[model samples]
Structures are given as C-alpha cells and as structure tokens.
Target: MPQANWFPRFRLFLLGVLCVVPSSSLFAQEQPGQFVLTPGVVVDRSANRIFVVEPSDALATVALQSNTGEVLWKNESATRPLSISAGHSLMSLGSVDANRLGVLVLDGDTGKVRAESPLNIPPEAATLAAPLGEGRLDATAVIRGQRGLLRWNYTPPVTKQGLPPGTLSGLPNAELIPEVAQPQPALNDNPGGFVEIDLETGEQSVVDPAAAPNFAPANDAPEQPLLPEIPGPKYLSADGRHVMARERTKGESHRFMMLVFDKQSGEAIGKFPSNVSYVPFYVDEGRIVLQKEEFAEAIDGQLVKQPRQLQALDLNSGEVIWRQPIAEMKFRGPPPP
Candidate 1:
C-alpha cells in the first residue's frame, strides 16, 4: 500500500521548511518532516456552504455562512474544481484575454463572482502551472455540452536541478505521476496535457499525455462534477442526499484526529482536527462540514503542520458548529473560488 511512487513530497513544518530523510532512503523509516495535504475542506451541501481552501502559498479561501457559519467570502479563484456543469460551479485556470489560455467558470454560489467562463488554451503552449513551490492536483470529466478532459499537473522545477521540490519524481503521478526524468531546464516550461474543455461553448483543445480520455465513464456518474485525484474516504453531498466519510481519528497516527462519517449510517458525524480538501458537506439533515489542519509543535525534530480552521458539525449534536480561521497563504492568485 506504499506506492504512490512511494509518496514523499514533504512540506509543512509550519513553513519552517526542512525535509531530510536520507538514511539511504526507502522512506528511511518515514518522516521527512511530513505534513503537506491541502485541498482543505469543501462542503457545499447544495448551498449549506463551508469551503476553506487554504493552500498556504496561494489559495486562501473561506466562504462560510450558510446556517450562521459566518464569514461569507474572503477570496476566490479556485484551483481546479471542474465538474458542476451547466451551472458550472468551480473550474479554475482562467484567462481568455491577456494572452489566450482559459477556464474560469465559477459560480461560487452567491458568495459573489457569479460566472467566469474562459479557457481557450493556446498562447504558445507550455505553462500548465503548480510548479515553483506547490499546490496542484486536478482531474476532470466535466460535461454539459460535449468534450471534456483537463489533466493539468505541473510539479517540475527542482530549483533548476538543485533539487528540493518534492524531489523524487518518476511521475506516473504515482506511476502516472512517477515518470521522473526531465529536470534539466524546466522541460518545455513544465507541461502535462489533456485540456479539452468545451463543456458548452467555453471551447479549448489540447490532448497529448498519450491521448488521455475515457474519463472513467464520465467520472463515475452520480451526477458528474468529476474531481478525483484523491477526494474522500467517501464524501458526496451537493444534492446526492448525503455521504461523508474521511475517517482517521487515529490509525496512521502522526498526530491525527479527524473524523466525519455517515457514509450511509456508519455514524460519527463530524469532529475536525484537519486533513480533507475536497467535499465533506451534508448540511440540511442537520449539518456537518469539515476542514481544519493544525499539528503545531515539533519543529526541528519534525511534526509541523498548518492550516488553522473552518469547522461545522452537528449531525445530531456532534457539536462544533462554527470555527473559521486560516491565514498564511502566499504566491498570490486570488479572485475566484
């Protein structure tokens, strides 16, 4: 179970930034200052609201206020959420002006910025994004009109070969993200293909990554919003009725304590400590939303995690109804979420 290319793209020492682990490697008994997981909670429960993106280098989102979660709107410019079609709710990667390259489609549900639409791709290619610090992981199946692909994952710029940017890429993206080779000059400015968007007139095209398309039968239809790079121990709300699960109250412990299950009666409604980045919202049958990250302590000896809060629970008194608080995100890129 240890083969996401052997996972070790370490980051999160509370931004003290330090990762060693080289006893000869093989995970060297794990712990390269671990703790780097951000998608940071996203539970829109058909407008019950509670999104807290917080990528801390750029992403800083927060749109609470649905049943008094308070604080509706901070900054929005979503980073690849694609698949809330027709009414298109989150699809990032914008700009159909300033030089072509598009994809903005944001509705963000009355938190402001209603509709963006832009992603025409083609301004000399090469510049997919998410490289030069970190914060990226996209996978789409978008459908409303016709063709839809979107695979964009940058991650390549080992400081111009000085290493220290997740360092150990063979990129198959975990085999597909595990093809590590090109580290000699940004390799065509860091690219990875398949951005076929046309989910109805937004139009754009580009494919190579070996022709990529099959979209797993349209991202396993359950009413497609197609987003899976790793989204859940089981979440599904936004009108699918209810289905949250992100368990780990202690099992792979590294200072973990996170729960949110009700995967159809497994119980354990909500209890956030943090670690869940996309979808975990039920709101309505009584409430439940998740996203919080705070490991705080152990700096040099290692155990650094950060991403303050954004909580909501009460699926029948699970308690912790409102928490919101996440600050410290740089690299600038705010305008849609």
Candidate 2:
C-alpha cells in the first residue's frame, strides 16, 4: 500500500513541476526592462515619467526610466524652453509676446512629441499643472488662468473651457469636456483624464473646477470668499480625490491632515491627521503610506540619518494600519556604537 501511494505522490509532484516549468520559462523569457518607473511618481501609474520646469526659466527636463531604474530618454530644449506638468506632456510659452501657452504632448513610451496646441492664456501665467489621460500625446491641459482655470483638450483641437469660481481651482475647464459629465470615467491616461465625484449626477467622471465654464454672458455665480477656518491645502491627490495638508495650531506642533475630498464636486469628504512633517505619502488603493524619517544619534559627528518606518494609513477608516520598519541591514554601519 505504501509503494502504491508513492507512485501517486510521484505523479502529483510531476504535475506540479510541469505547471512550474511553464511559469518559470515565461518569467525567464520576459525582458526585465519592459516595466518602466518602478513605484512610479504620482499614485497614477499613467504618469510614470516626470519633467521639471527649471527655476532658471530656461529649459525643462524629462525624467524617463524603465521600471528597472534604467534611464530610457530625456528631452532638453534651450530655444523654446518647456514646463511639463506631471507626465510626458509639457507647456511652453512660445514667446513673451505670445498670449498663449503651447501645450506639447509627448509619447510616454517613446518620448516623442506628437501634437501641440496653443492654450489661450497670458504669457505671465505662474505655473502649469499636468494630468494623465488617454494616450501619451492625447492629454488634457489644466491651465492656471488669472481669473480662474482653463482646460484644453489637446487631441480634439484644443477645446477650451473656463471655470469662474465655486468650481475646482486647478482643474477649471474640466466641465467643458463631455466625458466628465458621463457616469463612467472619460479621460484615462491622457494628461488630464481623471474622474471626480459628480455630486449632481452622483457618479464619477472627470474632475470639475470650482466653477463651470461661462461660455456666454450668462449670470455667473457670485465668487465665494476663502474660508476663514478652512485649513490650508498643501498637497493634491494624483487621482484628485484627496489633499494632504497641514494646519498651524495655536501652541501645538503643526497639525497634518489627510483631507479626503470629492474630486468632481471639490467638496470636503473628511480630513484625518497623519502627525508627521515633510514626509512622502502615497495613496495605495485607499491607504496612505507615509514614509517617515528616522534619526540615529550623532555618535561620530557624521550627518547620516536612517529611515526607520513606513507609516501606513487607512484613508477610508482613518486609522494607522501598521508601521513597517526599515531593516537595519539596509543601512551601513556607523563609525562606532
């Protein structure tokens, strides 16, 4: 009977090996360089790359890398200069006299410029914000306007919309896009394709600004004054659902809050304290991973601080789930004890 059971065990083991062999082969066959930008910037995987508008007001630089941390490509323009939002797309003011910002779209995979549109805005615009949706080239531009916000749909010939007031601040022209009105999400991976909670329809679609675009001379709503007690907004959620901010307390240390908001309506959902400073936080699924800093006592008078723990927060429940510690082995040994 034992010998008979051995044969059955051998058959089961052989079957397991056969299944493992294919998976191992597939894993070995796949190129390790296929994945790009590990962990990715912005919670939005779509905006895997990042570009910085240089402080010198000169040219902009793209930060492109494979998922394996390999530098894929970079673009630097000295003539026109560039200001990219968050992803492959960039904004370039053609000239000081030009009254518009040229929205330049680029392929995320290949870093190729595909299209350009002149966003109707004054050259003196302070900053440019980018969102991801659709393809690498096809994206929405959320232009920071003097009065309000201007949204431009780059693919469909730069459809313009303006948000006066009471709409979302940064994403002013979001309402002009029809996809934002729909129940399902419209803008996918394009520059500005994120759905917000549409309060009127009670559905998720593209995020709307504080006020809808006043295309005609209609009775624009009164501008709402800034709230006195409202805490200052410090961070914008990549998906446009929440804002991580800090409020100064009378005598206490700085109060940190993870402000959950309705992306569509720009209404406050809830705010929870994270109780940390200058820490990098990420919204994974619905949880917030606050990468906290840890310090080791200055023993040999060297400036080497070690990271200690990752504070994880449950955004929905507003609770600290766990504090994952950084393994001591990850850090080099100090000069002495």
Candidate 3:
C-alpha cells in the first residue's frame, strides 16, 4: 500500500470536500486539458502510481499513472473496477463482468497482471471485506440471504535466488473479522454472536453474544429515536486489542461520546467527550490520527468550507497529545443566499 500517512490524509481531504462542496464548484477549479477524475480512483503513493477507472459509452477504462501525473499503462480489458487493494508490492483489482467476479493482481510498479482469480456468485452479492495480508487474500461476500468468507494464499513469483523483490517484502499479516449477524430471537435480543472461520484449517466456530467483548445491553428507551448505526468502530488499536466506539447522547444536546473497550473481553476501559464525529486517519506505532470536520462556512460562490481541526491521541493514555486548527484560505466566494 502507499505510505499510510499520505493515503489517509488524501482520502480525508477528498471525503471532506465531497461532503461539503457542491459538484459544480468542485470541478470548477480544474485546469483546461486536465483529465477529470471519475468516481473510482485509488492512489498507491508508496508505489508512486494512481489507478483510475474511466467510465465511457461501453466498457470502462482502467489506467495507471505516476505520482507526477504521468501515464504508465492503460488496461482496457477489464470491466468496471470496483475496488483496489495493495500489499507486498502488489495491487489487486476487483472487477466484474456479466455474472462473474474477477480479481486481477498487478505488479505495483509495472502495472502488469501477476495473477488472476475469477469467482461466480449471485449478481446481488456484494463484497463485505477484502483485505490483503501476509501474501494472502481474505474476503467476505454477502447476498440477500447468505454470506461467506474466503481466504486465498498467494505465492508471488520469485527470482532464481528464491528471494522476492524489494517491493514484495515486508508485508504484514492479515487480520480477518467476520460480520455479526442480526441477533436471533432465541438469543434474547443480543445480536453479538458471529461466526469465526479459520482460514488455514477450514474450521468454523461460533462466538456467543454473551462472550463477545464490547457487547452492551440495548438502550431501552422507546420514545427516543435510535441514531443511525455505523458499520464499525471509529478507531481500532494497531494490535486490534482495543476499539473506540461512538454513541450519540439522547435529548436536545445531541452530543456524542467516545468509549474504548477491550476487543475480546468487551469491557469498557476509557471514555471521553467529543464535539464532532471522527474517523481514524492513521494508526501505527502507538499513535492515532483522528480526522473530524468541525463546521463548514458556505461562501456564496466559493467552494464549501474545509475542515478546521486535527488531533493526535495517544493509544495508551487516550489523551490528546496535540490539537491544531487547519489554516483557511484567504480567497472567499460569494456569501450564501
């Protein structure tokens, strides 16, 4: 994967602009003759390349470019590329054609297909997770009435000395988590049970809701509207031992709270108050970067306001090491009507 620092920071900015600014103003600043990026674009900064899928009249175009905006290669064979994953100096492209799902693993530096895997699933089935780790591919797919977990062990091509290239080295091990199904009526409203599959041994085990960590009793206030549930935690420790959960307070204040819990024991360890919702931007080496949008100022004709703050929190202490306000640009658009 591209350097963790640049990838997350760039994604944060992209998400903020998309959420706050209108589409018209977003493209207004593009220079003439520049290639307009579409919806599916993935950047591999560590490999100094950007993968883009360009929609067209027929099949979408897939192209790879250097960090300096130079085209390295273009692939017109694949259909719409849904998502991309990178690891061990390789990039995997998830694509679809008709009723078949395909994965094309590419050389991160050369944009060449090193391996390809095709799967057949119902058209309605969607990929729940596809993370690459330790020269292996772990994925989950969910259909309307079914779900499955899959693991693929990848063996990269090697040289005569039996050593992989520099780009294929230092890959981290994969961490796989199964999706918890809705609570069964027999389980008494506790939806914490999930299936765990051993990718290596092909064994399956069930984790009971009562035994799962971070399992909290449901809020029983009938009059209060339940906030929209986020799919996962706001942050997880590097070792996956701890998770930070976000909850919205009831009543008119509409405030939020962050609580840390043991991943296995489901025990609350620490709690803190927060003004805005946040997402983990970077997590490594005992530090975490949380990105949040405080507020947006709408200029009548200018782009929407950008995020105003960033904070670094220590994983061990759950304390803010530093907080800083992002500098705003001087140029302003017309005031909102």
Candidate 4:
C-alpha cells in the first residue's frame, strides 16, 4: 500500500478552517458607518487611524476614523478627494476642482489645514501620487491628457533631528535612540520619468528616465538567477524596499501566487499561494493587509453567502500572521429602496 499524502491534505484542511473560523477576536471591534472604502484609502497604523474618501455627488468628504471604527473628523470641500498620503504629523490631500488641480496639507492630529497650493498641470490629469516617508510631502501627478508628470515639494514641520516632531513624540521610547539620517532610495527603475517642481522656489526641471540608477546586483555577490516573468499588477511598498505582485502558475490557470521581491536588487524574496481575487488594502510595519472573498451556495437558489476575509501577511517571511472573517469590515452601500 502506498503512503497517504497527509501533509498536503492537512494544509488544505487548515486553510478551510482559517476561512470558516468565526471566533477570531480581531473582529470584536465596533463597525464603522456605511462608507464605501475606495481604492485611495490610506491607513496610518502608528496613529491608529484610517482615512477614507467618501464621494457623494459633486463634492467628496475625507473622513478619519480610529482603528476600531470611531469617526475622528471629516473634511469636506468643493474638490473631490483624489488621493491622500500621511507621514509624521502631516497628511497631504490631492484634489480636483472642475479643471483646477489642488493640493492641501493638513495637520495629521487635528485635520486642520496647514497649507494649500495649486499645481500647474492640465485639468484632465486624474492620477495623484504623494509622499510616503516620514516628514516628506513631495507629490506627483500623471497628466493623462498631455502625457507628462507633475511633481511638487512641500516643507513639512520638522524638529531638531530633521524629522517631524509628531513622529518622535509618538514613539514610546524616544529618548533611548540617537538621531540619524533617513535612508535614501536609489532612483526608481520605472520607465516613466517625471517633471520636478520646487514649491518654494517656483523652479521646474525635467528628469530623464535613462538617467535613473540601475539596481543590478554587485559583481562581488554570487550570481542569482532571475525569476520567471510574472504577468499581473504590481504593488510597491511605501518605503520602496519591497514589491509584491500576483502571478499565475504555469500550466494551471486557477493557481495564483503572490511573489515578493527586493526593490533594491530586484531579487525574488518569497512566494505564496493566494486567493484568485483579493484587494491589497495597506502595507505597514512589515505586514500587508488584504481583503479576500469566498462564496458559498445557499439552499435558497437566489441567495449566495459571500464571506469577506481579512488577512495579514508578513512581508519578509511570506507567513500569514492572522486570517479572520471580517464581514463587518466589508464596504456597504445605502440600503435598497
């Protein structure tokens, strides 16, 4: 008699348990309002808050809520909230008003407007990219109508160490560590170069894509074979240290994999099986959170139970820290008439 393949079967059984388990303690928190969380939502784990852009009709509101779903503050204006990014004690909002492009900086703790500026880009430009590192407020926007990139800088409130005071104040043990310079990332390898503008000086320059630094491995390091090219959307970590993408397995259309790579060297770090469909929510503190859905047939032919799951994965080890059914966290629109 052949030995049974117990390990594979056990793995599948464990996955099923993770998907069906309803006793997870993480879901005990109160549920927030029926705000539809769009793709541009931003999470600040250090401040224990989540910022979401809620659009109604002509105007949009940006609301900040605690991790447990308590509404902190809501800022509403004439422009629609395009994108939001937070760092240190400040948060920047990229917005669009009719044909005008605007950027607003707010105090992260109080949601008060600290500075407001306008970008000199085409009105049709819709995409916005903002800074992610601490005390950084540089932003970029893609001009779809003119095929150009718009970039601008903002001077964030800094302390003696050159970092935002809120960042150091929030630390539990701030006095124990010495001040140091932030790590500078090599020029990104993305093919799209951008135009840089100094908000303070009103100067602009075009950056050539070819001049970007190449991240190839050093000659002294052992040669590492490149990973097979994977076709899927790519998501880069906020700090530019890691990249993650969804890839389909060869010869198996149904099997999907999540591959993580080192952004500096372009080397594959780890890969793991993943749900065929999932939404990447946020990446912070070396972990990535994703929302996945699983459907089950119901006895009533017209009704199907779709369970939403929240999963946290450690970026370095590709290990699942926790998997919980979070149906309450799923976005809910207004009730049917």
Which prediction has the highest TM-score against the true structure? 4
**Residue 8, model 4: Cα distance from true site in angstroms:** 57
Give lDDT tens digits, candidate 2, residues 126-238: 11112212111211212221111223232211223444454554676866744423232223323432222211122333445444432221111112223324455455433
Q: Write candidate 3's Cα lDDT for 1-337 as tens digits.
A: 2233332232222221211111111222222112111223333434544454333323333444332334566554433232233341222234434233344545445655555555432111111111111111122211111111222222221112323334333545422432334422121121112333332222435546454333221221112111224334355432234566678877633367766666557666665556565443333335444444455544786656555544556656766665433322111322232
Global lDDT of each candidate:
0.41, 0.33, 0.35, 0.40
Candidate 1 lDDT over residue span 124-186, tens digit each: 222322222332323333333344455544333232234466555654445444443444443
Residue 186 Cα positional deviation in candidate 4, in Å, after optimal superposition:
38
Regarding TM-score, does 1 or 4 come out ahead?
4
**Preferred candidate (TM-score higher): 1 or 2:** 2
Report the C-alpha lDDT of model 4 over 112-182, residue by residue, as the tens digit: 65555555532111111111111222233321211223333433222223476567777889888777675
Give the lDDT of residue 40 in candidate 1: 32
Which should have the higher TM-score, number 2 or number 4?
Answer: 4
TM-score of 2: 0.28
| TM-score on alpha carbons, each prediction | 0.26, 0.28, 0.27, 0.35
The candidates, ranked best first by lDDT, are 1, 4, 3, 2
| Top lDDT prediction, candidate number | 1
